[model samples]
Target chain A: MAKSHEETADPSIYVPSQDEDMLKKQKKKEWKETLVGYAIISPWLLGFFLLILGPILASLYLSFTDYDLLSTPNWVGFDNYINILTSDPRFVQSLTVTLIFVFISTPLKLIFALGLAMLFNTGRKATGFFTTIYYIPSIIGGSVAIAVVWRQLFGRNGAINDILNSLGLSGLNWIGNPDTALSVLIILIVWQFGSPMIIFLAGLRQIPGELYEAASVDGANKVQTFIKITLPMLTPVIFFNLIMQTIGGFMIFTQAYLITQGGPMDSTLFYALYLYEMAFEYLRMGYASALAWILLVIIALITIIIFKTSSKWVFYESEGGR
Target chain B: MKKQNSKISDVIYYTFVAAFGFVMIYPILWMIMSSLKPEVEIFGNAASLVPGEFRWDNFSRGWEGFGGIGFDVYFRNSIIVTTLVVLGTVASASIVAYGFARINFKFKALLFGCLMATVMLPVQITLIPQYILFHNFGWVNTFYPLIVPAFLGGQPFFIFLLIQFIRGIPRELDEAATIDGCNKFGIFYKIILPLLKPALVTVVIFSFMWTWDDFLAPLIYLNNAGLHTVTLGLRNFMDADAGTNWGALLAMSSLSLLPQFILFAFFQKYLVEGIATTGIK
Candidate 1:
């Protein structure tokens, strides 16, 4: 490679009239390098257009039309959207259930994660082992097998109910009851708090020790330091975890699908599960596309709202203040 | 007095940690023990941690899965899909990351921004149209739907991760390579690729775990029992209408977790580091 470059850069072979030729060659080389760059990135660029960009635009168009899989799409304009807002009872219920799942599970999971993180942050000897143990749930939490296990665990004669029975209480069919089905799913969601716990642990580590030392010296108690120092310092990480967990909470399908199948009264009919049913099972592809768009809009709106409000509470130690 | 107070706190802290650790790992322990018990003994020994008898036949029975298919076939299918996905993800993501990290091409910032935006875009948004597209291409019920998009850089998260990693590499090395008459590809091949082992390992481990555990994509595409991944096969075992074989199901479930458990044991440092870095970014 070095020899070839030296041969190309040889000065003795060049004359004053060949300067334009050399300049042209340089321009060509530059263009060739640019093309090479594009060539290298073309896989992602092609996927972006075909899979992401094209699908997004197609979904937008499909949202306006009434296209089932077999038949040609008939243009229905905003009728699907309007009906979803006005008359579709299942849609309304799914939206409510999804919102409730997101609202309930996100905060609870965060709190559980934050609590564990704080406890572990005290520098225990077995912290590594404990962290690994906690993280196992989040790894397999979304698997079908785990969901099946969770189903059995909350079944009529399952382990949880067995424990309940042994404690001088009657066992309730937790997964079978419409009222408790969603709660059971929420418990599963909260149980997988290991990811956020890790993030919060990292955040806790980032908090300067001098702040705590100074607070202790000034006679502040643990609660005061937590509220006034640790919490404020960790707000950015909390904000990140909140957004990610909320988005994940909204898109939850497998657990609902595997455990309840949107069960006893459609009590656990999550948004993504409903969309899957509409598209694949019902073959209402167009309406499902519309539902997909609505989910996107809801996520976007929630994200925007969070970002808009983040300035109030999300402190950055580097920025000093917003 | 301070040391005495701290000692008491330490005792309380360890106790709390131990209790919570037990709660965290109880389900896994229960699953393992239940898998060893007889079908009737599962519910009977539900509240107990130990099995009365070690019925090892649960593994063999579960290995002989429902409807002429077996757990061996499912595991084979999963391995095939996951291996291809890991290869495709690492190759495509590294090249894409090199482009964004090293090259100053036209529309670079805009394209990078779009890539970032897609990371936040829910998979549900793209589900239907992609499904239709694949259906039109006669790729339904095949591994094509699961594997091809990966080769085309479908996962923006991995690309972005590699971009961060490649960006951290020194620009001086590229300039030096360029002065030595090495082309852009040469610079990448000679320098950046060799230096990207850590991030590439992170990507490989994540891609393996995600692909192994993925349920929805296979559920959507692979309708045939023969092509079913492990997740789909496990779901078939829990057919809501049919009476579930709890022993076999739990046995297979435990088996499904073995690969992940082993991977975690070996690569715990990289896994935790990957998650931490991703979160901070």
Candidate 2:
């Protein structure tokens, strides 16, 4: 039985010389491929070293120094961090604003985008047209012009209030009021939900039609089918949307920078915007680097937590298990 | 009975979706109308859905209002910057992506992962040091800082997207080319380049949209109003210190969106499909 098992396993294992020669030739081929590959991929490697990796390493060193733009950086161990964490209300405010924006916008976006995706998925007529129309806002929506338009629309005499007045109502100064400034931002973000919606639509297509058909034949109602089949199938896409939107939201800057100027009482001071103000406006390069590092840590922690939690809820089709 | 129930549910769904759509689109519609409304009528009848007069002259005024630097200059500058950036980025990113996807380098996966991590790193972290570096290099206040890095494969997202697409192509094609005595360069040129047309289109479109809309880079790098991109030019026009011309600003804003709108209308299908293919994955 042992001999038979050994023979079945391929006697190549026992013939060491033959195996070694084959392995040597395989390694030689692999070496050639690797060399050729390096030749082709050299551009990216060069880029990483020169542009990305080099800058990253430089920033790490700069964060340790009291560096302004004009002068040479002097070593100032942890002073920047200490000052930012302890003495800086601006940093705290920026953090609070960014967190609020991320929390509100991420959930709202996922719901709006997923809902719109469902709408397009169901609607029989010109689904492509609706998809395109919905997506237009996201494509052009990041411009300073759009942010300016958003500001005008929400300003004291802006279009939003105009509509409210037409309805025989008083209007709140949306962008000018501290309480409403960030809310207007939230609205702006939710409006640009078209990109995620397209992704969800693609995910929706991947769901087997027979599952829905089966659900219908089993006397399942529309809500029941959606709940039992569609939602579960779409969970992966929803997970993707959640992570991406969360990350995107955390990096929010342009809307606040252009619209509110982080104003109406600093209520809209997003972290990155504040970083810009510190580095450029105030010329506190060291402090700005510290802020950047803090933002990085926060983003990293959130992403790690998301990945850890994903194992519990994220469904994988190949595994045949949720 | 089930059919009837589903019909009602569908109606409910449509109502919910339509309400969301109305809200989603309302601000844009409102902006368009507001752009047409005169200053006198703006606040007086703020809620009027229709403008009293379609004040088409707002465009002309907005275009010419910026201290003799017509909106045409900013528009033209933006076109130049975006076109060059797109061409440069697409070319570099494809070459780099091809290298990563099709080549068999040592530690290839590790290197690729390192490249992707750059994407995760907030652009802000690199912002200060890069600005300083550029300043020392005398690239500041010029289009060099804006456009040169793109040619150096600066953007990780486009490279990653291209890599994913390149990997999906069959390796057998490369082997066949090699058997037919095509060199590595020939395989890349003849076999891979043709296959990557769809991905290249996607890269071009994305680069166009991003470069056109970028404000902060131009705000930081370019100091001269003469060299201002559309985003910067419009903001400069509306700056409170520079004297705000609301009507003129609105007109300029509308013009800024026109190119992207036109691009979208023409390539909406490819853009959407490309986004779905590359981004969603």
Candidate 3:
């Protein structure tokens, strides 16, 4: 209905004349193409503005006010931010736990992925058999079922301790101890390094065989060839994995939520779990909003840092990057 | 001597991978084995791989689920939600991908940039406000909150992947269709849709996997036990107090992973390829 006005008054825009017939046709085609393009993508367009963009901005606004979802938002500018940044112990605890998890687990997970990928890439015809077996965990790892199993595996008199005691080696209740709880979560994470391993395998394949052959011809050993040829070539993939896993590491929830419940004095209270508790459990939506904003800032900063520093270490084969 | 040494290294490689693979899947094996163990035997001989007697009734007992609701209801709920989610994601993502890959509209690049940025943005940033918005819509504690977003291009990763796939398709097909008097939409329907099958499969498998295993959305929305998905149902097993039915929990937990195992068995090639493509480039 709105376009009716534009259609009726379109003569001024493109006059139909003898000399300008082709040009008019071109203009009309362009207009139709644009219309079709928007029509095709309208779902995403509407979704973005409605679901994602609106909510992101609203959350930002809500972060500055006190809204408990039951009443109208009370404007208390920066109180959430002040208390979170200044004096809140749990906030500090969560931040510390998250940073520790991310910093420690990301590298270990990537390394494990890379090591296994290299092992798988060792020119064996039967390696596909191994990858299939190993990738099962990454598929089902995020489920509550697996998390439940993990809790049992590390329970006080669970299988781990039973096996340890049988071997005359006492094992601590890994999931029940503050000192070892985060390690349990880290192990869970590192164990599911299957997807990244596949990524590394793909990256390894793309490293030209000629490079390895040349290094071998030049009398380079395995470690030397890896360092001189493989590592630098794989840096771009490494950088990608780092950014992704770092983001994912910070968002660790299901494992910690189910396995330890952030227990043993909040030793494993991931940023996400805490934020969830604040919002839904405690009904401090405004403070949680602030915490969520702080998380976004932290993630954005870390991403930017990685990208900025990438120029120093990440080696793209050519400027025309893959 | 040199050949013998190389053969020994081969032996070492095979041994290491085999041993380590066992270590990797040990917990899962422990779980499946424990599912067959009696509750007393599950803990009493927890270190042992074999149970003295198999308690096959655990599966039946676990199938009864907590409260009055059975695992059948949970499975049905998950199947319904995941099916709709997968369909919506594939349909919407393919449509959007076609627009971006084939059409040259003004602001296309800008919108594409926004899509990529959304791919990088954390879900937590929008978690609260989306919850609030859904609450305003009176959609809380409903499957609508879990399934609606899929129809609306909520998953940028799928859109991004499909765009990459659609671009790889030769434009000559579209041009030929255009020459034959096929309109843009006709070309998309006739040419692009059929050709985009592989990418669509990738989309289907991933969307199915994620939605079926999705905990947060279901946790936030489906508070009623009658509507609990398998993941939530399994979580309730853990909530069953000190006299926990370890046998039932293990059995149900193992059962919860059946679909994933089936998918992995049948589509490991596609799954591996999807991971490779999505993870690296």
Provide the TM-score for each candidate, comma-separated.
0.95, 0.91, 0.96
Worst 10 residues of 1 chain A by lDDT: A1-10
Ranking of candidates on TM-score, top first = 3, 1, 2
- C-alpha lDDT of all candidate models, in order: 0.89, 0.81, 0.89
lDDT at B233, model 2: 84
Name the lDDT value of residue B257 in candidate 1.
Answer: 87
What are the DockQ scores of the candidates, in order?
Answer: 0.61, 0.53, 0.72
- Tens digits of per-residue lDDT, candidate 3, B161-268, equal 988998899999999999999998999899999999988888888889888888988888788888889998888777873336999889989998888888888887
Best by DockQ: 3
Candidate with better lDDT, 2 vs 3: 3
**Two-chain DockQ for model 2:** 0.53
TM-scores of the first chain across all predictions? Answer: 0.92, 0.88, 0.92
Mind giving the per-residue lDDT tens digits that candidate 1 earns over A1-322? 5336546775877654566577668767777767888899999999999999999999999999999989889999998899877889999999999999999999999999999999888876878888888888887787787887888888888899899888989998898899999999998988899888989998899998999999999999999999999999989999999899889877898889999999889999999999999999999988999899999999999999999999999998778766
Residue A136 lDDT, candidate 1, scale 0-100: 82
Let me know the DockQ for model 1: 0.61
Docking quality tier of model 2 = medium
Candidate 1 local lDDT, B3-49, one digit each (tens)? 99999998898888889889888888888889888888888767677
TM-score on 0 to 1 scale for chain A of candidate 2: 0.88
Report the alpha-carbon TM-score of model 2 versus the true structure.
0.91
